[model samples]
Target: MCIGVFKKENFEIVNNPKDAEIIIINTCGFIESAKEEAINCILEMAELKQTANCKYLIAMGCLVQRYKDDLIKALPEVDLFLSIDEYDNLWEKVAKLIKVEIKSKNTLDYMDRIISTGNATAYLKIAEGCSNRCTYCAIPYIRGPFVSRKMEDILEEAKKLASSRN
Candidate 1:
């Protein structure tokens, strides 16, 4: 939904992180390996700030919320870290960093999504975090409780997803 959210604010979502002026990695830190992978991914994407078109290196999602302090100290390359809760204000923060005026603020009706995955497949995240208390998992603590998105929004997104093929 990050794509949908940012697109609402008129931000372009490019195919390559190298081509993007703003690169946001919405991560999942459910498990140890996932956390490791998320960190590795951050390190990987952080490289684009120098070699690529990336200017705003943002790390958002479970990892940010869970380990905000440590990651801030560890990864100085990351321009900013947005926790799962802070996603609602993503465009505002980015706009300030990029020095661009927001065309339409407070509109969450964006359904246009850039197909990032290979082939025709796409991943649409309907909800974030997990509420369930799985003893072995960190999603609840890291990502917070699971909340279902509004049914209307989900249907609208689905419609747009189908229409994109046409």
Candidate 2:
């Protein structure tokens, strides 16, 4: 859903900071190692922003969902912070950051205007939010658990994306 709402070719996905302008680091906070990786990514992006004239640095995904306040303060250079729960609002958040209003009543509508990877790939989110009460994990607490997408809805989306691309 998120990937389908951006002009993908407009941004080069790179692990190296030397070749990109905007860096949207989808981070993971599921474990200590993941946290370290996320921090390292932020630091690298910050350096690139300083020396390479990178215009925007956005952090999203699980790391932000887990450490929203800390990430905001620690990486002051980060231009935007998007939590996991905000996956559906990716376009809105990005539009606000770039100061451009993409007129759309729904995410799918917004996706039509935006160019996805422009490739033959797409992600279909079958469900949103998790309801597990695992203590170490924050997803269930933050997202409130899963409500499965109807089989028909999933099939419909898959068929649409596949057929359109084909």
Candidate 3:
């Protein structure tokens, strides 16, 4: 049950995150409480961004991705918003914020060199978007139809990650 042991330490797990130039907040939008938590986290990070010299507050995960425009209108502090689909090129956006040139034919190639917390752990994202039409749900609308990534590409990324680190 210890999921933390399986997680990758990509975030600045620190008391003071304002020291970092870029902040990536992976939020939850599954339920009301979760949404509130994500909002509060975003607002807190936004405040940190204001006074801590945090140049960019990149908001990813389900909250912003599911509620794209609404989240944008509510929080103007977030510099970039993306979903699970955008995680593939996540480093690129992060690099752009820091003014670092990630010259790679494929971002995965660059990511292979990046040190991950685990040698056996890899975030294998299979696909993105959804088409389930629920009257109260906006996921289908926000993400459009489900678009499956080619198996070859995914396998390649997995192979790279597997070969590199956890």
Candidate 4:
């Protein structure tokens, strides 16, 4: 969904972090190791600004949602830190940072997604977050309460994905 927003904005999706002008890293903070990995990856990409074409580094997802303030203070090299909740107006924030006018009014539409997995298959997101607040789990905290997409929307996305593969 997030990648879809970038595509809608006509941002070039580069395979190499070193080649990208705007680098966005979606991270996992489900466990301690995941957090470390996310931090390490962000730091690694931050170096691209000095060594390569990278101009802006954006870190987001579960790790940002959980430790945005801490990450912001620790990672001074990062240009922006966005939590999952901030995705609603993602284009607005990105446009402001890059100094570009908002080109897409509806940037989060599922049908606009560029399938990165390949033409053989595509992943459909039916819902987000977790309603069950397990004692040891941090999903509810990081992702907030579970909210299922409407059945009609999910079905529509499924049909779109299915047709695209054929």
After superposition, the stretches of candidate 3 with alpha carbons farther than 4 Å from their true spots are 1-16, 79-117, 134-138
RMSD of 1: 2.9
Q: What's model 4's TM-score?
A: 0.93
lDDT tens per residue, model 2, 51-160: 88578889988888888998888789999999977766777888888887667733533234332456677667678677777777766765667888888878877777
Model 4 misplaced stretches (Cα beyond 4 Å)? 103-106
Model 1 segments more than 4 A misplaced = 106-112, 118-129, 163-166
Candidate 1 weakest lDDT stretch, 10 residues? 106-115
Error of 4 at 163 (Å): 1.5
lDDT of 4 by residue, 12-106 (tens): 78888877899999999899999999989998888778889988999989999998999889999988888888887888888888899765675
Best by TM-score: 4
Colliding residue pairs in candidate 1: 131-146
- The lDDT for every candidate, in the order shown, is 0.76, 0.73, 0.68, 0.86
Give residue 86's lDDT in candidate 4 (0 to 100): 84
- In lDDT terms, which candidate is top? 4
Show the colliding residue pairs in model 2: 129-145, 130-145, 131-145
Give the alpha carbon lDDT tens digit for every residue of 1-166 in model 3.
0112112324344435767766778787767998899999999999888788688888878787678789888888888887756666766665666676666523333223444346667577677667778889766665678888888878887787777763
Candidate with the larger lDDT of 1 and 4: 4
